[model samples]
Target: MPKPGKHINHKGRNRRFTNPEELEEERRKEEEAKRWRQKRGEVSSEEEEEEDDEASGGSDSEDESSDDEEGKKAKGVSNLIEIENPNRVQKKNKKLTTLTVDVPPEKPQLSRREREEIEKQRAQAHYQKLHAEGKTDQARADLARLAIIKQQREEAQKRREADKKAKEDAVKAKTAQTQKALGKK
Candidate 1:
Protein backbone atom coordinates (compact mmCIF):
# COMPACT_ATOMS: atom_id res chain seq x y z
CA MET A 1 0.00 0.00 0.00
CA PRO A 2 1.11 3.55 -0.76
CA LYS A 3 1.96 5.48 2.39
CA PRO A 4 0.12 8.78 2.83
CA GLY A 5 2.19 11.83 1.91
CA LYS A 6 3.08 14.23 4.72
CA HIS A 7 0.08 16.48 5.43
CA ILE A 8 0.57 20.26 5.47
CA ASN A 9 -1.84 22.52 7.34
CA HIS A 10 -2.72 26.14 6.52
CA LYS A 11 -0.34 27.12 9.33
CA GLY A 12 2.48 25.44 7.31
CA ARG A 13 2.97 22.86 10.06
CA ASN A 14 3.40 19.11 9.26
CA ARG A 15 0.70 16.76 10.67
CA ARG A 16 0.72 12.97 11.02
CA PHE A 17 -2.13 10.57 11.93
CA THR A 18 -1.82 8.97 15.40
CA ASN A 19 -3.99 6.38 17.18
CA PRO A 20 -6.22 7.97 19.87
CA GLU A 21 -5.94 4.79 21.99
CA GLU A 22 -2.13 5.03 21.92
CA LEU A 23 -2.26 8.73 22.89
CA GLU A 24 -4.58 7.92 25.78
CA GLU A 25 -2.26 5.08 26.91
CA GLU A 26 0.75 7.46 26.82
CA ARG A 27 -1.19 10.10 28.77
CA ARG A 28 -2.18 7.53 31.45
CA LYS A 29 1.45 6.44 31.83
CA GLU A 30 2.68 10.01 32.10
CA GLU A 31 0.05 10.76 34.74
CA GLU A 32 1.16 7.66 36.71
CA ALA A 33 4.87 8.58 37.00
CA LYS A 34 5.38 11.48 34.55
CA ARG A 35 7.40 8.71 32.69
CA TRP A 36 7.97 4.90 32.11
CA ARG A 37 8.62 2.70 29.01
CA GLN A 38 8.74 3.38 25.26
CA LYS A 39 8.40 2.23 21.67
CA ARG A 40 9.56 0.35 18.04
CA GLY A 41 9.39 -1.21 13.13
CA GLU A 42 9.12 -2.14 9.36
CA VAL A 43 12.51 -3.88 8.88
CA SER A 44 12.36 -7.68 9.55
CA SER A 45 14.52 -9.29 12.28
CA GLU A 46 17.12 -10.27 9.68
CA GLU A 47 17.20 -6.78 8.18
CA GLU A 48 17.30 -5.27 11.65
CA GLU A 49 20.29 -7.44 12.53
CA GLU A 50 22.07 -6.30 9.40
CA GLU A 51 21.35 -2.64 10.22
CA ASP A 52 22.58 -3.20 13.78
CA ASP A 53 25.80 -4.69 12.49
CA GLU A 54 26.31 -1.73 10.15
CA ALA A 55 25.61 0.70 12.96
CA SER A 56 27.86 -1.05 15.52
CA GLY A 57 30.83 -1.22 13.13
CA GLY A 58 31.23 -4.85 14.35
CA SER A 59 34.07 -7.11 13.17
CA ASP A 60 33.66 -10.25 11.04
CA SER A 61 34.47 -12.45 14.09
CA GLU A 62 31.72 -10.79 16.08
CA ASP A 63 29.31 -11.31 13.15
CA GLU A 64 30.29 -14.97 12.97
CA SER A 65 29.80 -15.37 16.73
CA SER A 66 26.38 -13.74 16.51
CA ASP A 67 25.43 -16.01 13.62
CA ASP A 68 26.48 -19.09 15.63
CA GLU A 69 24.49 -17.92 18.67
CA GLU A 70 21.40 -16.98 16.65
CA GLY A 71 20.77 -20.46 15.29
CA LYS A 72 16.98 -20.17 15.78
CA LYS A 73 15.30 -20.85 12.42
CA ALA A 74 12.02 -19.27 11.29
CA LYS A 75 9.05 -21.56 12.07
CA GLY A 76 8.04 -24.12 9.41
CA VAL A 77 9.86 -22.33 6.56
CA SER A 78 11.43 -25.64 5.59
CA ASN A 79 8.04 -27.19 4.85
CA LEU A 80 6.86 -24.17 2.86
CA ILE A 81 10.17 -23.92 0.94
CA GLU A 82 10.23 -25.92 -2.32
CA ILE A 83 13.07 -27.07 -4.52
CA GLU A 84 13.61 -25.31 -7.87
CA ASN A 85 11.83 -26.78 -10.95
CA PRO A 86 9.72 -29.28 -8.98
CA ASN A 87 7.56 -29.97 -12.06
CA ARG A 88 10.61 -30.88 -14.18
CA VAL A 89 10.73 -34.58 -15.05
CA GLN A 90 13.70 -36.63 -13.94
CA LYS A 91 15.55 -38.99 -16.30
CA LYS A 92 15.41 -42.69 -15.46
CA ASN A 93 18.49 -44.87 -14.98
CA LYS A 94 19.18 -47.01 -18.04
CA LYS A 95 21.16 -49.58 -16.05
CA LEU A 96 17.99 -51.05 -14.54
CA THR A 97 16.63 -54.19 -16.27
CA THR A 98 13.49 -53.96 -18.42
CA LEU A 99 11.30 -56.86 -19.54
CA THR A 100 9.83 -56.79 -23.05
CA VAL A 101 8.15 -59.88 -24.47
CA ASP A 102 7.04 -60.15 -28.09
CA VAL A 103 3.65 -61.73 -27.87
CA PRO A 104 2.21 -63.54 -30.92
CA PRO A 105 -0.37 -61.55 -32.85
CA GLU A 106 -4.05 -62.51 -32.60
CA LYS A 107 -5.18 -65.41 -34.83
CA PRO A 108 -6.90 -64.23 -37.99
CA GLN A 109 -10.54 -65.22 -38.62
CA LEU A 110 -10.87 -68.26 -40.92
CA SER A 111 -13.05 -68.15 -44.08
CA ARG A 112 -15.72 -70.82 -44.74
CA ARG A 113 -13.37 -72.82 -47.05
CA GLU A 114 -10.52 -72.49 -44.54
CA ARG A 115 -12.79 -73.60 -41.70
CA GLU A 116 -13.93 -76.69 -43.68
CA GLU A 117 -10.30 -77.56 -44.48
CA ILE A 118 -9.32 -77.24 -40.82
CA GLU A 119 -12.27 -79.46 -39.78
CA LYS A 120 -11.24 -82.09 -42.34
CA GLN A 121 -7.64 -82.01 -41.11
CA ARG A 122 -8.77 -82.39 -37.48
CA ALA A 123 -10.99 -85.43 -38.42
CA GLN A 124 -8.15 -87.09 -40.35
CA ALA A 125 -5.72 -86.45 -37.52
CA HIS A 126 -8.17 -87.92 -34.95
CA TYR A 127 -8.77 -90.99 -37.17
CA GLN A 128 -5.03 -91.55 -37.54
CA LYS A 129 -4.50 -91.15 -33.82
CA LEU A 130 -7.27 -93.67 -32.97
CA HIS A 131 -5.80 -96.22 -35.36
CA ALA A 132 -2.26 -95.61 -34.06
CA GLU A 133 -3.47 -96.21 -30.48
CA GLY A 134 -5.33 -99.42 -31.58
CA LYS A 135 -8.58 -97.86 -30.32
CA THR A 136 -10.31 -98.48 -33.73
CA ASP A 137 -9.43 -102.20 -33.68
CA GLN A 138 -12.67 -104.19 -33.27
CA ALA A 139 -12.76 -106.55 -30.25
CA ARG A 140 -14.19 -110.07 -30.65
CA ALA A 141 -17.34 -109.07 -28.78
CA ASP A 142 -17.77 -106.07 -31.10
CA LEU A 143 -17.32 -108.32 -34.19
CA ALA A 144 -19.96 -110.71 -32.86
CA ARG A 145 -22.33 -107.79 -32.29
CA LEU A 146 -21.72 -106.54 -35.87
CA ALA A 147 -22.42 -110.02 -37.25
CA ILE A 148 -25.65 -110.29 -35.34
CA ILE A 149 -26.78 -106.88 -36.62
CA LYS A 150 -25.97 -107.96 -40.25
CA GLN A 151 -27.89 -111.19 -39.78
CA GLN A 152 -30.94 -109.37 -38.49
CA ARG A 153 -30.85 -106.92 -41.50
CA GLU A 154 -30.59 -109.80 -43.97
CA GLU A 155 -33.52 -111.64 -42.33
CA ALA A 156 -35.67 -108.52 -42.50
CA GLN A 157 -34.86 -108.06 -46.22
CA LYS A 158 -35.79 -111.70 -46.98
CA ARG A 159 -39.13 -111.35 -45.17
CA ARG A 160 -39.97 -108.16 -47.12
CA GLU A 161 -39.18 -109.97 -50.44
CA ALA A 162 -41.37 -112.96 -49.49
CA ASP A 163 -44.33 -110.72 -48.65
CA LYS A 164 -43.99 -108.84 -51.96
CA LYS A 165 -43.88 -112.16 -53.88
CA ALA A 166 -46.98 -113.46 -52.06
CA LYS A 167 -48.92 -110.25 -52.93
CA GLU A 168 -47.98 -110.51 -56.66
CA ASP A 169 -49.03 -114.19 -56.78
CA ALA A 170 -52.44 -113.41 -55.20
CA VAL A 171 -53.02 -110.58 -57.70
CA LYS A 172 -52.19 -112.92 -60.65
CA ALA A 173 -54.39 -115.71 -59.30
CA LYS A 174 -57.41 -113.43 -58.88
CA THR A 175 -57.13 -112.12 -62.46
CA ALA A 176 -56.94 -115.66 -63.87
CA GLN A 177 -60.05 -116.79 -61.85
CA THR A 178 -62.04 -113.75 -63.06
CA GLN A 179 -61.12 -114.51 -66.73
CA LYS A 180 -62.24 -118.18 -66.31
CA ALA A 181 -65.66 -117.19 -64.80
CA LEU A 182 -66.28 -114.73 -67.69
CA GLY A 183 -65.46 -117.48 -70.25
CA LYS A 184 -67.96 -119.93 -68.62
CA LYS A 185 -70.83 -117.41 -68.62
Candidate 2:
Protein backbone atom coordinates (compact mmCIF):
# COMPACT_ATOMS: atom_id res chain seq x y z
CA MET A 1 0.00 0.00 0.00
CA PRO A 2 1.22 3.49 -0.86
CA LYS A 3 -0.12 7.03 -0.58
CA PRO A 4 -1.71 8.47 -3.70
CA GLY A 5 0.89 11.31 -3.96
CA LYS A 6 3.92 9.03 -3.34
CA HIS A 7 5.35 6.33 -5.60
CA ILE A 8 5.17 2.68 -4.44
CA ASN A 9 8.78 1.95 -5.49
CA HIS A 10 11.57 4.49 -5.97
CA LYS A 11 15.33 4.54 -6.46
CA GLY A 12 17.26 6.73 -4.08
CA ARG A 13 20.81 8.12 -4.04
CA ASN A 14 23.27 6.88 -1.36
CA ARG A 15 23.66 9.16 1.67
CA ARG A 16 27.44 8.64 1.81
CA PHE A 17 29.99 8.42 -0.97
CA THR A 18 31.37 4.98 -1.86
CA ASN A 19 34.91 6.34 -2.24
CA PRO A 20 37.28 4.76 0.34
CA GLU A 21 39.74 7.68 0.13
CA GLU A 22 36.99 10.15 1.04
CA LEU A 23 35.96 7.98 3.99
CA GLU A 24 39.56 7.69 5.20
CA GLU A 25 40.03 11.48 4.85
CA GLU A 26 36.85 12.07 6.89
CA ARG A 27 38.16 9.74 9.61
CA ARG A 28 41.53 11.55 9.66
CA LYS A 29 39.76 14.94 9.97
CA GLU A 30 37.69 13.61 12.89
CA GLU A 31 40.82 12.36 14.62
CA GLU A 32 42.54 15.74 14.12
CA ALA A 33 39.49 17.53 15.57
CA LYS A 34 39.51 15.19 18.56
CA ARG A 35 43.21 15.86 19.12
CA TRP A 36 42.59 19.60 18.91
CA ARG A 37 39.80 19.31 21.45
CA GLN A 38 42.07 17.36 23.77
CA LYS A 39 44.77 20.00 23.40
CA ARG A 40 42.29 22.78 24.22
CA GLY A 41 41.34 20.95 27.47
CA GLU A 42 37.76 20.42 26.23
CA VAL A 43 38.28 16.61 26.31
CA SER A 44 40.20 14.45 28.77
CA SER A 45 43.47 12.91 27.51
CA GLU A 46 42.70 9.58 29.24
CA GLU A 47 39.39 9.24 27.37
CA GLU A 48 40.97 10.20 24.08
CA GLU A 49 43.83 7.75 24.65
CA GLU A 50 41.30 5.00 25.38
CA GLU A 51 39.44 5.84 22.19
CA ASP A 52 42.76 5.78 20.28
CA ASP A 53 43.60 2.38 21.78
CA GLU A 54 40.20 1.02 20.79
CA ALA A 55 40.55 2.43 17.28
CA SER A 56 43.95 0.72 16.98
CA GLY A 57 42.31 -2.56 18.12
CA GLY A 58 44.64 -2.83 21.09
CA SER A 59 43.73 -3.77 24.68
CA ASP A 60 45.46 -2.46 27.85
CA SER A 61 44.73 -5.39 30.16
CA GLU A 62 44.90 -8.43 27.85
CA ASP A 63 48.44 -9.53 26.91
CA GLU A 64 49.97 -6.78 29.07
CA SER A 65 53.21 -8.79 29.60
CA SER A 66 53.44 -9.69 25.90
CA ASP A 67 52.83 -6.05 24.92
CA ASP A 68 55.66 -4.93 27.23
CA GLU A 69 58.12 -7.42 25.70
CA GLU A 70 57.10 -6.45 22.17
CA GLY A 71 57.36 -2.74 23.04
CA LYS A 72 60.84 -3.22 24.45
CA LYS A 73 62.00 -5.22 21.43
CA ALA A 74 60.51 -2.61 19.06
CA LYS A 75 62.17 0.18 21.01
CA GLY A 76 65.52 -1.57 20.91
CA VAL A 77 65.26 -2.16 17.15
CA SER A 78 64.17 1.44 16.56
CA ASN A 79 67.09 2.76 18.63
CA LEU A 80 69.57 0.67 16.66
CA ILE A 81 68.07 1.72 13.34
CA GLU A 82 68.07 5.39 14.39
CA ILE A 83 71.69 5.19 15.49
CA GLU A 84 72.62 3.64 12.12
CA ASN A 85 70.62 6.26 10.15
CA PRO A 86 70.01 9.69 11.67
CA ASN A 87 68.06 10.89 8.57
CA ARG A 88 65.34 8.28 9.26
CA VAL A 89 64.71 9.72 12.73
CA GLN A 90 64.22 13.18 11.23
CA LYS A 91 61.78 11.81 8.63
CA LYS A 92 59.75 9.92 11.31
CA ASN A 93 59.59 13.10 13.43
CA LYS A 94 58.39 15.09 10.40
CA LYS A 95 55.38 12.73 9.91
CA LEU A 96 54.58 12.79 13.66
CA THR A 97 54.83 16.59 14.05
CA THR A 98 51.44 18.03 15.06
CA LEU A 99 50.03 21.24 13.59
CA THR A 100 48.93 22.50 17.01
CA VAL A 101 50.34 25.99 16.83
CA ASP A 102 49.30 28.66 19.34
CA VAL A 103 46.76 31.10 17.97
CA PRO A 104 48.13 34.59 17.40
CA PRO A 105 46.09 37.77 17.91
CA GLU A 106 44.26 38.98 14.81
CA LYS A 107 46.12 41.57 12.79
CA PRO A 108 44.78 44.34 10.60
CA GLN A 109 42.92 43.15 7.52
CA LEU A 110 44.86 43.28 4.26
CA SER A 111 43.57 44.81 1.04
CA ARG A 112 42.47 42.49 -1.76
CA ARG A 113 45.43 43.50 -3.92
CA GLU A 114 47.86 42.87 -1.05
CA ARG A 115 46.41 39.42 -0.45
CA GLU A 116 46.61 38.66 -4.17
CA GLU A 117 50.20 39.86 -4.31
CA ILE A 118 51.17 37.61 -1.39
CA GLU A 119 49.49 34.64 -3.03
CA LYS A 120 51.23 35.41 -6.33
CA GLN A 121 54.61 35.62 -4.61
CA ARG A 122 54.04 32.31 -2.84
CA ALA A 123 53.03 30.62 -6.11
CA GLN A 124 56.04 32.07 -7.93
CA ALA A 125 58.36 30.82 -5.22
CA HIS A 126 56.83 27.35 -5.31
CA TYR A 127 57.14 27.23 -9.11
CA GLN A 128 60.72 28.44 -8.96
CA LYS A 129 61.60 25.71 -6.46
CA LEU A 130 59.98 23.09 -8.67
CA HIS A 131 61.71 24.51 -11.74
CA ALA A 132 65.07 24.23 -9.98
CA GLU A 133 64.30 20.59 -9.32
CA GLY A 134 63.26 20.16 -13.00
CA LYS A 135 59.85 18.94 -11.82
CA THR A 136 57.55 21.61 -13.33
CA ASP A 137 55.78 21.34 -16.69
CA GLN A 138 57.43 24.56 -17.91
CA ALA A 139 60.85 23.24 -16.89
CA ARG A 140 60.28 19.98 -18.77
CA ALA A 141 59.11 21.89 -21.84
CA ASP A 142 62.09 24.28 -21.74
CA LEU A 143 64.73 21.50 -21.51
CA ALA A 144 64.92 20.97 -25.28
CA ARG A 145 65.04 24.71 -25.96
CA LEU A 146 67.83 25.12 -23.37
CA ALA A 147 69.84 22.30 -24.98
CA ILE A 148 69.37 23.82 -28.47
CA ILE A 149 70.45 27.25 -27.25
CA LYS A 150 73.55 25.76 -25.61
CA GLN A 151 74.49 23.95 -28.85
CA GLN A 152 74.03 27.17 -30.87
CA ARG A 153 76.24 29.15 -28.49
CA GLU A 154 78.95 26.48 -28.63
CA GLU A 155 78.82 26.44 -32.48
CA ALA A 156 79.02 30.25 -32.62
CA GLN A 157 82.09 30.19 -30.32
CA LYS A 158 83.75 27.53 -32.52
CA ARG A 159 83.05 29.59 -35.69
CA ARG A 160 84.53 32.72 -34.10
CA GLU A 161 87.68 30.84 -33.10
CA ALA A 162 88.08 29.37 -36.60
CA ASP A 163 87.65 32.82 -38.18
CA LYS A 164 90.25 34.32 -35.81
CA LYS A 165 92.74 31.51 -36.61
CA ALA A 166 92.23 32.00 -40.37
CA LYS A 167 92.90 35.75 -40.03
CA GLU A 168 96.06 35.09 -37.99
CA ASP A 169 97.29 32.53 -40.58
CA ALA A 170 96.69 35.06 -43.43
CA VAL A 171 98.66 37.71 -41.52
CA LYS A 172 101.54 35.28 -40.98
CA ALA A 173 101.63 34.39 -44.67
CA LYS A 174 101.66 38.08 -45.64
CA THR A 175 104.58 38.73 -43.24
CA ALA A 176 106.55 35.76 -44.69
CA GLN A 177 105.94 36.95 -48.32
CA THR A 178 107.14 40.49 -47.51
CA GLN A 179 110.25 39.14 -45.68
CA LYS A 180 111.08 36.84 -48.66
CA ALA A 181 110.74 39.75 -51.11
CA LEU A 182 113.06 41.87 -48.97
CA GLY A 183 115.59 39.00 -48.76
CA LYS A 184 115.51 38.58 -52.59
CA LYS A 185 116.11 42.32 -53.09
Q: Rate the local accuracy (lDDT) of all candidates.
A: 0.70, 0.76
Q: Which stretches of candidate 2 lie over 4 Å from their true place?
A: 1-125
- Among the numbered candidates, top TM-score falls to 2
Per-residue lDDT over 1-185 for candidate 2, one digit per residue giving the tens place of the 0 to 100 score: 77787874455754755799988999999889878985765665355456756766666634553454454423236656644555654434444357545768689899999999999999999999999999988898899789999999999999999999999999999999999989963
Q: Which residue pairs of candidate 2 clash?
A: none
Which candidate achieves the best lDDT against the true structure? 2
Model 2: ten consecutive residues of lowest lDDT: 67-76
lDDT tens readout by residue for model 1, 73-177: 445576478657879998977643474457687899999999999999999999878766657755445667889999999999999999999999999989889
lDDT of 1 at 166: 97
Name the runs in model 1 displaced over 4 angstroms. 1-138
